[model samples]
Target: MRRYPSLVMLMLACSVAVTACKPAPQAMPVDPEPAAPATTAAAATPAPVPARNECPYPKFDAFLKHFGNEITLQEKATADPLLDSHIDAEAEPEPRKVESRLALADVEWPVMPDPAALAGQGRELQVNTLADGQRQVQIRTPDSSDQQTYTFAQAPCWTLVKREDESI
Candidate 1:
């Protein structure tokens, strides 16, 4: 997907103006590659999206018991076949397909942080329940230099959920 230079400039400017504390996520340049023939029935329809928009992770004491905040996400990035990058001339000039799949069994879950471990520490955690039922957690550790905030949601982009403004 080719982005317009002017539009990209505008977005960059807007992001710079809006976020001064944290780095804004920049859009990755999309390079469309050729697609291969689909032989399976699963390839006929598009991949299904999550049914709900709520946080998929457990929260509060339950979170501490099971998975304590530490999480990792794995994704498969793909684009249309509009470039020659996916083509192989020496081996089968005819493109069969270009795809990568991640098996559920292949995913390795990280060790979750124990809430009890942070009990005696001066770190303070503030969990806010939003109107949309998602939770945003703000962590202000003993070191006043840096603070971190994260949101949890059912969508793949759980961290980008809106939060209550604390500008006042």
Candidate 2:
């Protein structure tokens, strides 16, 4: 009876040791994680949009009317049109004299002459949208007048781009 008890205890210990040394059963196969929700076309691609809107000028006169009018100039924020770039590439170029009525629109401007209200001074201001899609405003003062041409190609605002004294 004593030997039978010892034999039973040895067998139980051997079985427990064998089970502990055995590798854990492999995990059962599962559905491939739902295929990660397929990437939609909209999610993968970006929307196409134009960089800038077309220039909005019905008539050049109406557009430049903002230049001579005090209230109009204030509403536009920019007294004179922005100069995107200069036409002449000279290192030291002569100053382009734009008229006072229009020049005074930019009060703090130092280089340009913003004299007294000269709209009543009888200066012929001509604005035209060129065939190349730039709005050209020409200001012709008496004989000493310079060829100062402005362009508004980038936006609705005018830009003084070209100037050559006595060219016109």
List per-prediction Cα lDDT, in the order shown: 0.43, 0.47
Candidate 2 regions exceeding 4 Å error are: 1-59, 71-81, 84-119, 154-168
Candidate 2: tens digits of C-alpha lDDT, residues 7-113: 88888899999987887666434554454444465577787753433323334454455444444343343434333333342435653433323343443433222
Which candidate number maximizes TM-score? 2
Worst 10 residues of 2 by lDDT: 109-118
- Backbone collisions counted per model: 6, 0
* Per-residue accuracy of model 1 over 1-168 as CA lDDT, tens digit each: 156888888888999877775654564434423333344545898887665333343334454334453443211111111111122224564534232332434433332233455556666667787797666666555545334454554334233222221211
